[model samples]
Target: MNEFTMNDLMVLMPYAPIIIVAVTSLLAMIAITIQRSHFVTATISVVGLNVGLFTLIGQITGVIDSGAVVASAEQLFVVDSFAKFNMVVIFICALACCTLAYAYLANLKDNKDELYLLLLLSTTGALLMVSAQHMAAFFMSLELLSIPLYGLLSYTYMRNRSLESGLKYLVLSATASATILMGMAFIYAQVGSLAFKPISLVLGSMFESPLLILGAALMLFGIAFKLSAAPFHMWTPDVYEGAPAPIATYLASVSKVAMMALAVRFLIDSALLALPSVQMLLVVMATLSILAGNLLAVRQTSLKRLLGYSSIAHMGYVLIVIVSIGAAADSISSMYMAIYAFTSIGAFGVVTLMSSPYRQSGEADDLSHYQGLFWRRPIITAVMTIMMLSLAGIPLTAGFITKLFAILAAVQGTNWFLAAMIILGSAIGLFYYLRVMLTLFKRPKQFIEFDVAGQWGIRVGGLMVIGVTVVIIYFGVLPNSLIVWSDMARIW
Candidate 1:
């Protein structure tokens, strides 16, 4: 029998955030059984998430002060600067989502307390994902992150779209997971290892093997599906349209961020990006996603769907920086993803806040729903406008800075094609984004009554809107701080 060592315990310390969330989830479930109260459960969830976030920050600070930390469990988990950076992003997004969910779930007719448990569990999975250094850990975390989403997506089980979305996601995600597992099996059979570093060490020698290449391709396909990149993005719009607003926000921000971090880690740490075939695949996918996403979004009347398509394009842009993995790639990718997360949260936060409590449909997601929004909810309208502008890459907004960073990364890597496609995509994106803005300010053909009556949830949501708006504008004006921070958070 082996005794536990200090290194083993130290390795576990970085996982405090995951541990905290998991415990809180169980406690929340127990509390739900003891007494079912939405406010009480929400309070517990929010407090737990906040505490988890703080723990994550402390771990990050320790890493910064001391050095990178790796778990003693066969080096399968690590808390390097890369992991810390992504964990911080995931925790912040989770916290914001929990805050938004408090209000969003308050008026729902269904049993809502359990949603928080799922949220915490999903976040725990995401935390595990970004820190996963081994393929086995990666797959386990992927399922953990995904399984809860099915419940969260179809939380409003009575609605037809909710049911459809959940079923679609469950089926598609299961297929993707199986594909990934197969790929992992193939790679394991060939390389005889599940850890990233060992596989990387042997990849060069086994580079010519058809099984290895096939495995890599399948894994990339699965990852691309999760990221909703290009042809694999078919499920995105339907899921976004059908899911509750807060859940949609979680999907767009938290889930994507975690997956992006994992994808980057795999590509870089495994040295898989060195292969020309892999590079070409990424480039092709990025190009198609950029062009098709923007083009398809132009005709969207549903704001949720529009944003879904926009996310596809945004991820394509992120992929551009990812493919150009150089000295600046990781920093640029982090900055780009951070800006996207904040702006996306702000965008969906407005949508979540505007969601009518009495509507059976869940959220008012249509273009007509927001017609003359500026005349009614000016603050939400302003926030939405900022987010849209940022998404469009307009100057003096975080989106513009993020786009510039991506373009710079492409230029630095001498990837002229991707740089041009990014510019083209941004230009195309502006039309739809500006169209939404125009609708917000348009004169209503007839006055529609709104429930101007406020609630605690709404007021808190307004504060979140204000907070995200300020961050967007601040970063847009003084981009240096975030840029420096992103640089410090480099993966490799």
Candidate 2:
């Protein structure tokens, strides 16, 4: 064979969607030089994202099932079907974010050309995190995903709560990053290499080593922080409550998807999920998250805060899928994740559209604001109701089918006890979900009418929610298309 050299890294060059996003950010900045209009920047960002998404489709189309695209043991990243699937999800999320941002920013005054650029760069980071194979890429992508969000969280400068949320995120995220780095240091000391496969190989032989356990524990803590699983999830409610509704939606949906994909990649590939100790730890976390999230959400009056807790619970269910199934059942996990993503985006998008900058923008969290929603915007209220029902896992909604897969997978992978608990949790969640729906129908004491029309963009986004809700219900009724593709797209 020819001499091994760094030049071989060129084989991985086809993974250009990550770089495309970075380049798009630069192009968006140049839009400022040519025309500093928000519309111009938004248009450019949307077009660039469209192109990037198509490029990923072309790259993965025929080859995704053949196996890892670039299997080299580089100390940084890997390109595989698993990563490709996640890249697809990330790209879709980015496209949706741009669509919503384009529409929303057109009305807001403070959003300059640079906001689109920041969004693109942030997406690039999330993409990288999904494909990352080692500590360096992991840390780099994690921070990339976060730094722009800090600014984006505070984009609504006039809103003091937005600024406060950004600052809180910055501080808490920094601590999480530090914990990850320290954990990585321990791993490097134990294995002498940061490549995940190599570390796993070394760890397999020394399973009982204290150093190995310590490193794994630390890594677990870092991942838990990223996943926002209970105990490490203290910042979620505050951040969700304080951020712009759209941005909060992106964070809760897309960002979590990327992180969970990464977590799946690490656990499945590293053979770490099979460990009894690790499995036990995740079980406890999942149980706590499910109980805490549902119980807390029932008491919350603020929609965002309720959603924050709901997300925590949703993640708990997703984790149960991850830990219960090994590589043989990864497609089910991805399918569940996709359903969750669509439902979350739809639900949060409803929140964003319902709360207008002119009226409910800063006050989006107050549930009373939606008191007379049924009479004001019938289409939106119906769409929101569908999404809420789906989330609550009522029969015939997308959420039900997706959740069914998770519960089924958990049952197949373990004893009936786990399935029983998950079912119990889902049942409890329905109560709160119905409570919100009841409030929507509760007639205001007086005839209260709210303005529903602002611009076509808002309406269009609302339509998107309706469209997604229709698909969700369709899938729930007939889940074969998603189930087939999910089965075929095995991560391991």
Candidate 3:
């Protein structure tokens, strides 16, 4: 066996963000034990996340200057342009979530310091996931990302809905995990190795085997559940409705984005995209998700639930690009994800800020709650309107650009069916998105009191909304830079 030495440690220097986040979680736990000050814990968590993000940026620069770097751990972890790009997006989303959570959680009666700890852990898990190259690492990192979400989802245990949402997600997510594990076991049995390269080598011979096909389908099912695609997306609206606005935003944006990135990596590296049956299955899922998500959202009154369905549809659009993996797929998918992240965060941030902390009743999530929002809060209403428009894929918005990119990719790949599905979905999506926008501008029948406890949090959240709004508009208008960046992010 090779001797373990200090030099081996040097190889992990590029993974400083993951290491920093893990260490920060430990520190937060200890700090919480000593003095359970939410502010102190929040500060520590924010600082740690910023440090980790900066470290990741530095690592990326170093790599660009001196080629890609593989971790010392036998290539189980990789530090490449693709990993780095997705990590940056994940980190930004995590940071925004942290900032939003600080304000949102401060008014809660319970001890909220541990929420930051869970965020750190979950972020660390996301970082690990993007870098993971082997099956063991992938599953471990997936759990690391998921386990913390269970706690975060139910952080407001005082709410019955939160508890119910947590339980539902836990059960479904566990079932998916078990399915994935079974699939991985089946693949390993046939290939005798769990690494991507070796598995690809054997995939040709194993392609005709029923066992391999079943295994691949199961694996796809598990990933689809995480993506909240149709046929496995029943959990989405309930969870989004029950979870706090910030947590819902994280789920819709950060968590889904990371999972998609990993899926892209796995499919490309393992050459699993070569399977005809798999492609057909994905096409079906994408088509159904697009139709089901939009049709369901059209009838929803709850803004959170509506956005949940909207996410499902948006993810369906992304899947179209994923299925059409080609020269432009990476750029299109990345741009689409980035735009979605910005819009989702902005939309949810508005919901989060509008909520009343002292009320023991429902969140400010109903469509009626936003009536005459333009009269009450024009800036916020404008931001929300822009977000909704983006989601609807309207022109002069990031969503439109991204959707166009997806269509272009589908056409380039000769997936005319998927291209048509996207157009139909976008047209259907416009109705609900417009409904929300109209509600924002409608005159209220009665004046409703808007109460928020954390002024500082409101300011921070507002700033985040403005920031994301600016980005959405900027990219929607001039998307060249983002397009170039996404093009640079090659999976293999």
Candidate 4:
């Protein structure tokens, strides 16, 4: 039994971020019950996230330097430099999403307070997952992260597209969950243990066992679905298109980043990547994701849908880092994911600020919505352009730097095919991204029903987007700092 000890409480010191957010959710719920004020509830979430982020940063100095593995007595959770580094991004992005949600939820007719509750809960789960060391923790954290998203996606339940997207995600996500559960069961049947390290030890000898292979394969399929790689990615564009912009941003940045971090830790710790069956499954998924994401995004006019598809491609790119198993894979994965988070948030923040879930006119997500946008809002237009350019992996942008890292990792691992795919996908991405930029500068539409207030540029959501864009540009131009930080983050 994983009995509690006084030492256990001290061991949990490193988990302040997860604890703070989890506690905040409960407090926010209580405060809402006392008096339903969206502002108050949101304020609590924002303040709590900020506190947690500060706590995380405060520990960064000692945590990153030592690369210490702080685990619960029972090993349900474990925090290391890798977890610390990824948690920084997760916490910051959750803060950004909270800000965006605050702005987005203001005009909703329905109760808005609960959305913050769900967001906080999901964020707590994401934080927990980055450090999870046990099978129970992994599944619990995943569900905690996912279940709240169902409600958040349908928060604007009045819209037809919103409702449809919610149902689709619910059913599809459940199927993936089942698949993952079965895989876990299979692995447990053979190994008689659910802890990651123990499973790795067992699988090392029985790697050829049918039970182990089937278990690893089933788990990989479920993970691929979560990553939205290739054939399993059909749900991405619809989910992104259906969910509110902020919710979509959370999906693309926070949860996806956490999942990738977990995947990296799992592969390394469990040694599943040693199996040819696992490697082949991932290689095929990575290749298909690159091809499908880039090709499909070209024909899409909706910026949100395009991003949804593009995100799939980006994950595929990250998958290359995972499969490469190079010495620099961790460094590369961290840098790529950090840049991806900044760029994705900036991009979706633009959509969120431009469109309103509350408005009957629906989101300003259509390509036509931005025609001649530069003439009216060049600053905002500039932000969008930068996001698109970065995502296209244009030179001197963070996206370019991250994509370069992924390619370098592939080459280092001797994965020439994956390296080629990275190059090809980036090439294909330019076509549609350029299409988007051109639309921004086109003749202004006569029916200008811009959603936000005139002074919105300096507001919370606007500031968040601008801030993220600035980080993207800074990291892109001078990536040494980012690279050095990433290099410090390794799974011990």
Candidate 5:
């Protein structure tokens, strides 16, 4: 009995980082009880996340290769390779955001400490979402992630636009949450079990019933809403435009990744998603999102809004490989997701650096703000160009490699039509992405001296991300190490 307990402990060892973060969050909250310092809280959070990231790396090889890690805290969570990978990604985003926020929020007044607390708690929620194995755990984690976002979006409490954005998100998210609960109730009624693996066993047999189909559809709707896919993405532009740049970056990068990771886990693990109708639904959604997102982005005048639409389109590309799921294609989606996460972070990091805390009311919008950026911040301008090019699927960047994988997976699925649309969409996307790049080089009406402050941390982060972009492109050209790694990690 003692041997069995020790073995279980070994399997569950990798998730200690998550536990540490949660504890550290509580400690920060307690610190607030005595005194309030947002920078100090952010410092503590960054340190914790950095330590956690190192610990996670230490455990990845052994745990992922030959063993599984599952941590149960009152049976609400279970961490394994998939969850751990996502948690690491989330932690990296969190660390960068904290650094950015330290600079971005230094000027803001009111509830700054509370903002840091909310951010940490929300991250914990996202971590829980990735690890949830049952319906109750799923619903709780989803709420934990969303509820904090409502506040985070409106952190600039006195601003009317920010308040409006918060209200819009709160209402829509509440409706979506209700829809998810109804679907889950139906699922429970049909399967008599709320656990994922168990429900998956009987999902196919239950699909003939309308209740099951409706439940699955509703559930997809809710999750899709979370992902900011088109048609359900009305809230994104407003939220992104109203929120501060750092918060916008968080939503654009880490928040979306966590939800996508959860979606991947569900579709792959839950056998019900294999039903023809479900698969077709997903494929159609991906197709429409790719087409519409690029087209809509072409008309956006605001930088944040354009990126919001661009993000939706990127999610569509990720969905292409996701819909083509099979043992032969798993690595395609994972690698694509990794590159997407990195590029999004880099892009948003640039945005945060460019934005002024005391800028215009709608600072999140108006691409004109980037006018003459090249003359002011040459290095970041170059980095942003690389990021935009990568996002547009240009050669010699991470985005290009990821898009190649998606296209390959789509071709293997025999969806030549999807391949064609992806090609066409990439063409349309290039115009908008390049339009911004052109702005960077454009000669402004007056030689404006933008008073942008320099932070070495951001510069270092941006350069590191650009270096990664170079490697991503290099791998595309060589097609050796990345392919081998993907091949090794591939699982149905």
Candidate 6:
């Protein structure tokens, strides 16, 4: 076999969409530094994402036409059907986030230009993460994907909660990073290699080694924290409640989807998910997350916090894909994740539009704030209604289809316990979702009027929410296109 070389790395780097995004971020940073123009900066960032997205499609088509999975020198990254599909979703989600951030930040008095820069940087990090094929790359990608979030979470400096969430995420994320590093150390001590495929090949009879399993478990612990799964999900609601609405959207969608992709890649490439110990651990986490997420959201009066808790359960549902083996499981998981991403965007986009940036009393995030919304703002009411229905997995929404996919995967894997949890959790989730819908028509609360309906920022955000809501309904009615696409994509 030919040896890995610097020339190969240099030639291959330009082929990845990550380079386009990274360069765009650099250019945006330069423009922001020269002149603090929020519109210019935001435009630059969005356009770059669009370019990166197109480049990604072009790259994938070229690779497929050539019928090859291209890994850079030293196998640090690989572009397969799975990477292609997930990366496409990441780009799309990031695009939506960019527009949402634009609308949300337009009303801000803070330095809005830098927030877009951080967003571009974070998007670059996520792209790097999804295609990582080596432990070193994975560890580096995790940090790249997380560090900018620390800044974004706290971007609204005037808000105490924003600052608090930023600090909370900083401390917790650092600890998680350390845990991941140590896990990598443990695995390296045994395998003497950090490339995923190599480790699997070298393990052979030693695949059941205590140290290896311990390392895998540690890594999963850190990842579960990122996914906000069950016991490790305590930080999720706090962060969601504290951060600005669009920032919360990024956390719920882009960050969640990227990590899930990496986790799936690690399990599949290392062949570790097949192990009984890992499988049982995953099932337990899945069960707790589903039950805990749905149960906790039941009592939430804060909409953002409720969605945060709800995300935990949705992630648990996504985990069903990880522990199961075969193409069907992978496809179903991707479908669920994509639906979750779009649903989250629509949900949070509505919140961002409804909440006031300069409200002395703070954002209009409470359930009472949305009560009787249908009387004053029928469009927002309809948008939020669809979001709630989708989140609840009601029929005629994309969420219902995702639930079906999860059930099929669970039964296919013979995981009856998890299948039962899926059913129970959705049943429990429906209660709170319907409660929110009821509030929309009851009586408008006299708390504090956000009165943002006339603002330009609100208009931009409102349109996006409506567009996303329409798509959700469309997919709910006809999911065959996405289903066929999912079947076409796979890691190998």
By TM-score, the best candidate is 4
Worst 10 residues of 5 by lDDT: 65-74
- In order of lDDT, best first, we have 4, 1, 3, 6, 2, 5
lDDT of 6 by residue, 371-444 (tens): 88888778778888999999999889999998888888888888887788899999999999999899889977
Per-residue lDDT for 151 in model 2? Answer: 91
Best by lDDT: 4
The predicted structure with the larger lDDT, 1 or 4, is 4
Off by over 4 Å in 1: 1-8, 62-68, 71-74, 326-328, 445-458
TM-score of 6: 0.94
lDDT for each of the candidates? 0.85, 0.76, 0.83, 0.87, 0.74, 0.83
Each model's backbone clash number: 0, 0, 0, 0, 1, 0
Spell out the clash pairs found in candidate 4.
none
Deviation in angstroms for 408 in model 2? 1.6
Residue 229 local lDDT, model 2: 88
TM-score, per-candidate, Cα-based? 0.95, 0.92, 0.95, 0.96, 0.91, 0.94
Please write out the lDDT profile of model 2 over residues 1-492, one tens digit for every residue.
353443444454556677777888898888788878887888788788787777777777753222235466665777666677777777776776666665566567664677788788888888888788777888898899989999988777677888898999899888888888887888788889877777767766877767766777777787887778887888898899888777887797678878887778777766767667788888888888898889888999988888898888888888888777766545666667777777877777777765544343464567786776787566777877888888888878778887887888788887465677689888889888887788778786374433344553345565666667788889888877767656645553
How far residue 486's Cα lies from its native spot in candidate 2, in Å, is 1.9
lDDT: worst 10-residue window of model 6:
64-73
Clashing residue pairs in candidate 1 are none
Order the numbered candidates by TM-score, best leading: 4, 3, 1, 6, 2, 5
Which residue pairs overlap in candidate 3's backbone?
A: none
> Ten consecutive residues with minimal summed lDDT in candidate 1?
64-73
